[model samples]
Target: MNTSKNRRLVILMYPRVREMDVASVNDIFATANTILPENRRYQIACLSTVDAPQLDGMYGMGLRTGPLYSTFRGEIDTLIVPGGMGNELTEPPEKLLKWMRKQGSSARRVGSICTGAWLLAQAGLLDGRRATTHWNQAHLLARDFPKVTVDPDPIWVKDGNIYTSAGATSGIDLSLALLEEDHGRAVALEVARQLVVFLCRPGNQAQFSVALKEQKTENTPLADLQIWMQEHLAEDLSVPSLAQKAAMSERNFQRVFTREIGTPPSQYVERIRIEAVRRKLERSTQSMEEIASACGYGSADVMGRSFSRQLSITPGEYRSRFRSSGIMAEV
Candidate 1:
């Protein structure tokens, strides 16, 4: 392997920055270094604005972060800003914001984890760019910065050289993506395997889980109806059947379901069935027709269409991309 070039990755740590966000991404690059030859490895460093020997993280843990001034003139291949409670401040420290603006301007790539998007936006780095942050804080980011396009659904997003991830664990996913972009799929996959994470979740994958989305309501009847819907995904889950299960008139059930679940009954059922089909596609070697039938889609074509409409990918394509390695041989 040619080892002529190395990347300098700097993670910016601030008081109360989320420890997991910084540590997880750091471990990924550090592990990648172990996987590649010495000359091809990444030089990772953590820097903080505080002129102290140790920076205190959100959870009161001490992190070894060099003074922020040390990084202002360095060649930063990638500059990472981590999110934390500190992001909630209306007026962030002026010095830190200035450094971020300067470093972000010159860095080859600039990225953030979770609410770090706030810092990037504050620095005017995300204006006119598409970005995502922790789902809970996404609205705030958009509200605070109207010029930036906020996408709340994706696990991570990359618009040009700027990348932003959803939440804590999503930072690891973003790091894997960066590794894949810097090296190759083989190295990224190997690193993911070592980390025991699902291999390379596409940036567009939903940050929310299907199970959690389905069970969002507290109403006993609605909760039971959701469970029933999941169990009988192959059965007709139309408004009438679900309303009957809930013992409410169809009109009333539709109103309440939409209010509590945030989706129409029909749409929710379709999403559930689609989620079921996706799991089978990722884990099983069964033919598409069989898996589709088992997941209540009735036919492979129907499943494929649903996958395309909802996920923007075909069932076969999803399987190829996300299927476990153990099932790849059979595929």
Candidate 2:
């Protein structure tokens, strides 16, 4: 690729970085360049510690990376750090941490994927900033770095010049957002299409899937109750109703559901309803009233409040930002 006008995007690699995290983000930018007619594209580079000439990723893939000293040249416009098993260590290599502190201070934008947020926190780049990491590691990150506010829900987050994402695939989501910022929504959407992903997911979208949340525990009664609730979303799902379905008293059912599902029964139902509403809003052009009714919110006004409370976006705004263009035309 031509380097003259291209923006420099350096991906900092470390031992045991997740291959998917690194490759997915790189592929998004690389693919964007191929699809865009513009001559200037993002120029990507892989860099590692001086002692580690060849970096080995989580999946045993070996990548030859430039020495950390190369980053001191200050040509980096964007810096991305990918995460993996290495982040579990209490202390990262001192040399790499120093390089991150320097590059992150000078780079136009700095970001991390998955557990990479931990590294950013260690480098003091994310202190007092809203950030996220893989859902499984979010608590640990917060515990390790009290100054950073860790939100485990978002697929990605942009706090000023810093960005962080939830997991491996979420790295692609963060990169697409960066592409949108650098290029435009049209270019990002085209890249998403070329990659055969659904249109770029909004950064605010939850990283956890509905299915994953519902199946988090192996309690057969609770599992069956969850299925019943999903199917009967439009019906009454109050504490008494759900308790009856689960063949338990209301108090007992509430306790078990909360313990297993990691959320109260009422809250769980609300999330399911919101997720259903979101799907309909993105896929169908139905009136808000119709969608609200179908999704068990009773009315558009009620659903509007739920959307604002849970997603910090109105139903109309969510549809405008996330509705697939092709689906919109068909609707």
Candidate 3:
């Protein structure tokens, strides 16, 4: 509102943007301003390719721009990129990549929400750095960009100047983290509260579907089987027993299981077990030994050690940090 102030954030919308991606970024910036006074918050604007009234987003959606579109000139401090499935159309255009590269030159930082990392890589911004995209697209990104290290495990990846996130609404997590980085943990928490969303999610925490996807099965009997498998997690769940529980021979069970879920019953059980352990650690007062027993671990020490190996953090610590502070994960 004043000539002396810097309204420094520029969000780059793809020709066909993911609606939620743009919405999340704009929401965070808007909420940050409301939380901090206008004097303290960053200036936010929609910077599309042109001075236009509306832009086409993915799924034939339309997004109207603010009063004016900002240029990539040095005035902008940060550049945010959001992804869409269409980016796989081919390598990014030379002019587009060049413009992104040019924009990055003076911006304080550059980041992507989900597969927007594709655009960043096309601009040569992600070379020789670690990044992530939507988990489903991670492999394609890895195969195409041999120089960029891909870590499918993180909700968001930050390597020096570049940041990439997992699919869709995970952009909110990335945006909240940016607020935390810019202001403080308190400001970030408050911003999340206003948005009615999670303050932050540990990057390595698997998306809920990460485990479920591998366990997909076409067996019409799988609903009953999966319910049975979940019910028996605390027990010594073996393939033969699960097959028996499903009323099928082990050979039939395995075939039906693979066809339906894409993974063997034994491995799928372990994933479900891990997810249970995390929950028990978070929302319950169960001791390590108790949780271990409940999740079919023979000993508390073994369970704790397994948790460390899998999560790189002790189960107790994870609980202390992330156990339901009232923030809801958007994913």
Candidate 4:
């Protein structure tokens, strides 16, 4: 089989950087290297903006990073900027932003992991383009750089040769996509299996999970009801049923639930059911009818509409894209 040409992957690191963001991208490419011939492997480097030989990272870890000056003029196939806690406290050095713009212009592709998108925006590299970062920090990115369109929903966003991924693990998904582009799906799948991650999440996948979003409800009754809803998905979850369970009138329950949860009770129940259906599809051999019934849908068709409404993809399509080899083995 023919493989693509070797590519140079450069990671730009800084003090207080999230170690996972840097490591995830590096590991994906490194794992791919173990499966590829020398001529087609990625050339990886971790460089720091500071002149120091060692840099402090988040969670009390120290990283050994090469000074950026050493490779300022070298050819770069792909340049990656990783997000850091420092992004919240201080701006990156002017020198680094200058270098980033230069590298971003020349490299075949440039990308960011998490808040690393901040640096790209600061460098004016993301001006007038769509991008995403860790969802928690997504608002700040958009507020600080109004010129850049920020979409917080996706695991990643790619515009032309620039890529930006949400959070740290999304970096893994981004790297796998890049690997698949350079090599093939088979090579990427092998690396994913070795790493024990989903093969590769699509760029448009939601950044946050349904469970995480549901946990944000502060109202005690609503919070308890959210948990109950998950456990009783197959049961009736209409406002009247939920209201009766909460011991409140249906009118009052609807008002309070919408105010506290930011979504109506019915919508929240649908989200929970869809999440359940998604997991079943990814990990089990259960037929669509079984999954739909278990997850509280009236039927497969009812479940399919809800899944497509939120995910823009149908249940069967989601299963085909995400059902891994391990799960297929069980069948």
Candidate 5:
């Protein structure tokens, strides 16, 4: 991978970084290189934040890294920052931040994976740009950096040349998007097929939220009711109906459901219904009316409105963007 012929891509590494965030992004571009011509390939270099030949990743994995400053000269085509446990601590060294600030201008594009958005924020690169990070840390990023517009829904965001993505494999999604931008949709899709990953996930697709899955619930009735709600989406899920099914008064049911589930019953119902609708849109050949009926939406218009309100995308648009290509061709 010669810098003179290939596109130069630098990955900024730090101790305790999330290994997945780094490895997945690197793998996407590396896989692309195998398919692309020599002159069009990506020349990837991993540069360490600390002056160390090796760094221990967040999960105790050993990784070899090059010295940050000793690497190269001239403009970088792409500079990526990966998130990890390191970001939970205090701000990174001013020198590192300064270097990033400088490179942010020189690099054709700058991106952060997961919590790496924090490093970019600390350097003031994302101050006025719309960005996203892992859903878990998105609030902290927003609260800490009031100047940056933090959108927690999307799996990734591209506001100008600065890109940010959600947790874990979203880095791969971001890399694929960059690959498509550099080459074409066909090349990126082939790379994704070779890698055994999804061809491409649109940036605006909602992050896989663990809204109901991760919530704590100790009451047997509430737990049973939650499962029942999912299996019976088309049924009346209003507070009165659910309360009767739970053998409790409406007031008590609402209070207990909210306390146990970490969200009001109505809101939780909407979220799960939307999740169901999203799955159908992506995988099934069903029409909007069919999906709406199956997902318990009263009508296609109701489902579209729900999608718009919750995901900021209409059902038709979501299907077009996320429907599996093979499945899409059959339609």
Candidate 6:
């Protein structure tokens, strides 16, 4: 019975839960725990709405929970809720909202994912502050609670003591952000690397994955072509050039690519280029001009404008704001 709780992170799990929501939170905490100084580790627990449940995940897998309240409530540090079927977003359970309101009053910090934002909003905790949720539910949140400003962009949002994230595993991104806020960028970055997470994705980053939208089907000819395109980012990419690479007529390639990916090939290439640029911004000290050239853009202006268009910030600004604290530095 050696319950060594170096850090406390409690998540409220619900039925029909997107497995990724739970897995993402668990993965980040697990990775962060491993990196903790031997004596300093995290303790994560799952609690159900009714205190516990004999249940299954969103995709129908078995699961469990613990007590209704934390044993270390006086020392409890962070409280989180995972998104699934029910929510405090539109119509909230008076009891659930009351309990959540109580937790928000007592805990050092409060957080939620996707529809979980709905719960917080219903609890009267999110009024007059900016927050976000899954895109499918973002509009609903705004419509229900006119007082809360809903930004349907960033993968996550922080409003003073309240935190909410986009759909599903964006919870990981939110957790990583909190890790950085609690420990430091270095620890969070390490956690992300260990989990093979792309980066400590900032709250200002896009909610949806452009690369995911454009990814080709597995084992298909187009899939192989897309992989090849990703590999050769620096090469001249034109309709004729890429069509030749795909072994198709330029006109046919353009039509087929648009149909499959929902965007023109050139736009997809730009999305990949921006992803590369964003990664460089986080991990390197390269100047905007250097990043643009390395990522296949012509100049700093191109990179800066592109970032502003997609991310609402200049490349230099994004790097300064998001990368100021060196990776592995103070959280």
Q: Evaluate candidate 5 by giving its C-alpha RMSD to the native, one decimal.
A: 4.9
How high is each candidate's TM-score?
Answer: 0.78, 0.77, 0.76, 0.78, 0.76, 0.81
- Lowest-scoring 10 consecutive residues by lDDT in candidate 1? 322-331
Greater TM-score among 2 and 6 belongs to 6
Where does model 1 exceed 4 Å of error?
1-4, 70-73, 217-266, 276-291, 305-331
> Could you give candidate 5's per-residue lDDT for residues 1-331 as a string of tens digits?
1224577898988889999988998898999999888888888988888788899998999999886654556568899999899595567889888888988898889999999999999999998999999988999999999999999989899988899999998898889878877887678778788888843566766777444463568888888888888889999999999999999999998898888888888999999899888777876689999999988988999999989999798989988877632221111
- Residue-wise lDDT of candidate 2 within 1-331, one digit each (tens)? 1234579898877778888987898899999989765667887887775456787778899877676654447578899988888685658768767877987788889999999888899999999899999999999888988999999998888898899998888888788778877776667777888888864566777897675666888899888888878888899988998899889999998899889988898988898999988877866779999988887887899999998999899999989887732222111
- What would you estimate as the lDDT of candidate 1? 0.82
Off by over 4 Å in 3: 1-7, 66-74, 90-99, 190-200, 207-210, 224-255, 278-287, 290-294, 305-331
lDDT of each: 0.82, 0.82, 0.75, 0.83, 0.84, 0.77
What ranges in model 4 sit over 4 Å off? Answer: 70-73, 217-265, 275-294, 304-331
Deviation from native of the Cα of residue 297 in model 4, angstroms? 2.5
Ranking by TM-score: 6, 1, 4, 2, 5, 3
Candidate 3 local lDDT, 1-331, one digit each (tens): 1223445888876567888999899898888888786667787877775467787888778988654333444466778988875785557657777777876676668999877888898888989999998888899899988999998877787787677888887888788777766776677778777877733564545554435655455555786678766777787688888887788899998887877787777777777887788766644677888899999888888877877877798888888876643222332
Tell me how far the alpha carbon of residue 89 in candidate 5 is from the true structure, in angstroms, after superposition: 3.5
- For model 6, name the residue pairs that clash: 88-118, 88-119, 89-118, 184-331, 186-328
Candidate 1: how large is its RMSD? 4.8
Model 6 per-residue lDDT at 283: 64
Backbone clash pairs for candidate 4 read: 83-116
For each candidate in turn, give its C-alpha RMSD to the true structure in angstroms.
Answer: 4.8, 4.9, 5.0, 4.6, 4.9, 4.6
Could you give candidate 4's per-residue lDDT for residues 1-331 as a string of tens digits?
2355788889988888899988898899999999999999998988878778888898769999885654556788899988788684477678778888988889989999998898899999999999999998889899999999999998888898899999988888888878877887678778889998854566766787686776787788888888888888899888888999999999999998888888888888888888888778776789999999999988999999989999899999988877641222211
